[model samples]
Target: MPRNSKRSTSIRFRIARSTVNYFRLIYQTFNLDIFELNPTASYPEFEKGLLATLKPYRRPHAFLPRTLGFAAAIARSAKSVFENARPIPFNANQPLFVASTTNQKLAIRPIFDEMTTDSFWFDEQCKECVSTHANRLRIPFIPLVMLKALLSKGYRRKSFRHSVATYCEIHGTYLAFRLAFASSRPSCIVISNDHSAFFRTLEQAARHSNIPTIYVQHACVAEHFPPLNFDYALLDGQDAAEKYANKASRSKVFLVGISKYSKSENESRWTGSPKRIGLCCNALDQTASTIEIITTIQKSLPDFEIHLRLHPSTPASEVDKLIRKCPAGSVVRNDAKTVNSFAFCKSVDVIICGPSSMMLEAAMAETPVITVETDSNTDVYGFQKHGLCQTATSAHDLSNLIADIETRDRGAFRKAISYFCEGFNSPSRPQASSLAATLIENISNRQQIPTNWKQSKKHGWWRYSSNEPELEAETTA
Candidate 1:
């Protein structure tokens, strides 16, 4: 059997085994009365159907005499997902790639490895290092396991994979994909951007792939890197373009902003008077220090009503503990409706935050904003260059800045908004998106012509030439 096909078969067998094992565990742990919840009935049915379907196929692991081993693996994978809450979309034949700079082992690789099966691919170094980490942690070696599964399943497909380790590596990854395309051809590519790497990969991927290369913008673009190019860049607003207009090249950036926040029919139950003081809590990173500055400001302005917006990653119990440490009536926990920091920006008068994208979102909402920047520990490229928010250098500075902002004229605040967001408008403004789309479409059209393509030598940073034919000024945007 072909490598890809064999890998797919092995994955199917293992998944079937795992599904059956998971169902058995659920039954053993919970009573029949617990299982009677109709809303949860589909899960059990799906598990059973998956198991029955796989029973006729050969099992991937020969050592496992029964389906119990598969069940254990399923339960473990499920536990991992519940803990992370990050969805891992899987496809047996699709080319998969992960772009990240952090050397630490990621939480999402299991999902991707399983999805790849025998047709799987990744940076060999990353695969080796991450596989070693998994082994050390006693996690199942799912990459090879999935490869075996895919082999049994008879999956045959071509996949090209790469990564962008840091902001600097984004361009290199793009170049690598371009070279890969010039050699071995692939159908399509999908670049997943999670804050750190920026959109450089998507731009290069579009340049290479004969088919559509989708861009899955992982966070609100305004809060992330300066925009570059993307065939179809997903976004929640024009705030990203406004904040990084100088950096954002023309591209077909799409606004499917926060699909999770799409309106539902259900009405909220609670209605209360708006509070005066608001706090945005974040991780202990440099960005979180902005919260510390905001907290200091709230202490001096004792009369203002304070509302705390917690980061999604923070535990509720930790937030409650932080609240208990604060002065009484000075902090209020956010209701479910306004839990996300961006949700709070639209309702608040003044938003004090660190170098978070939330500050940009607040600017997009036309709210007065102050960002506290203390020690140089947490600096990003665009924070200073774009003038996204008023920086506070110290606690006293923050308090004084807040006081000034509180009394500043509306025109002054609007001027600050203009400084941060150059082209504030509705989300539908398509300058960035249109530019990106046109560039990619033109490149794709050029590839269709029968002209001989040329490859340029890869050079160092200073020596790198921007003289490629398609890389002219028009497509560079």
Candidate 2:
């Protein structure tokens, strides 16, 4: 053959190899592995262990298949279990989705078969198996309520077991709900007030259903996670919104106001003293370091009465212990009066917290605030720089900060708060709730795909401006 022919054949071979490699990469990127199972697969072993461990509590009828393939099929079948699981669209006359953990019975009723026995071993083993496999499996097996019920079966001595059981119950309920609603809902939006379990469920549901989901950042927005393919995100401040926007390139991100204390009912009750100081308390044992910082601040400001509100999740006994540790008349036990955090924020003059959403709520209320970071690993400079709150790193710093706050120019602090909140104090201004509602409506409206969209060869969701010139020229002349 001639030299030109030989060169052409060589080039063709190289091109063929490159094409094969490119196709292989694409296949690996999008491949679904639900049907694949190996001999060493942990999911099967976990299922066997879980079934064996939970045998005493679980009904005989609950045992169906022990293999991975069968479990995948059951998970797939569960997708069609509910056809009307989506939330009703919000209308001017209709009420929005209300948060309810109220009839816990409704969520726990499905696990009655697993609540019969008082075997502590069965409960402990079941919880261990569930926690070990929860993050690894696509479908979460143990519901959170079932774990809670098992805990109530009298194994209080095992704290880790009890905690894992509580988590599993919540996780299991979320998983069951996700599988049930997968086929019914076109999309879902999760509104959570800083609960990791709720957020995990939202992510799992979105991934399983291949549906668009949005997360409204309900607290400090600095916490980072690997960006899921969320359709949109709403943040508490512009700085946070911009950070996520740059990081999550595919998602539509917006800087909306915080959502707490937005209701007219709560706003009407904002009658707390102008200079009152509020200290939001967490669990004494879990946040012992935080409580120590609070003690230091109390000693520095003996004249300033600090109103400490216990977290709703903290037990009554824990609150009592915390009160005893603090000076008399320094701790305020208002946990019973308010059902939600926003309601509690209404009566606070100045809020102090440790990476809590209460700090953001205080900012939304246009109140001066301080955020303490006891952990050296956590950075809170963004919160301080944004004028949302003053960041204190130690007990000594907090004590000095409290003293400084008393002498600081009140007018300057008010102006800083106003700038941070973007005029939230104005009587005519709409609250964060209204802003959230409006943004949701707008996004939902734009989410509709065109009827002939399938016929078009275009790849993206948006129209290209470059195509505009061609259409304009064709129509004009």
Summarize candidate 1's per-residue lDDT along 45-108 as a digit string, tens digits.
Answer: 3223323222332224333422344445445444544342211232233344454532111212
Over the stretch 323-441, how does candidate 2's per-residue lDDT look in tens digits?
78665666656773354555556666667775445666665554557777643323332556655668777778877776565444444444444433432344444555555455554
The alpha-carbon root-mean-square deviation between model 1 and the true structure, to one decimal in Å, is 19.2
The candidate 1 region of ten consecutive residues with least summed lDDT is 156-165
lDDT of the candidates, in the order given: 0.41, 0.45
Per-prediction TM-score: 0.42, 0.51
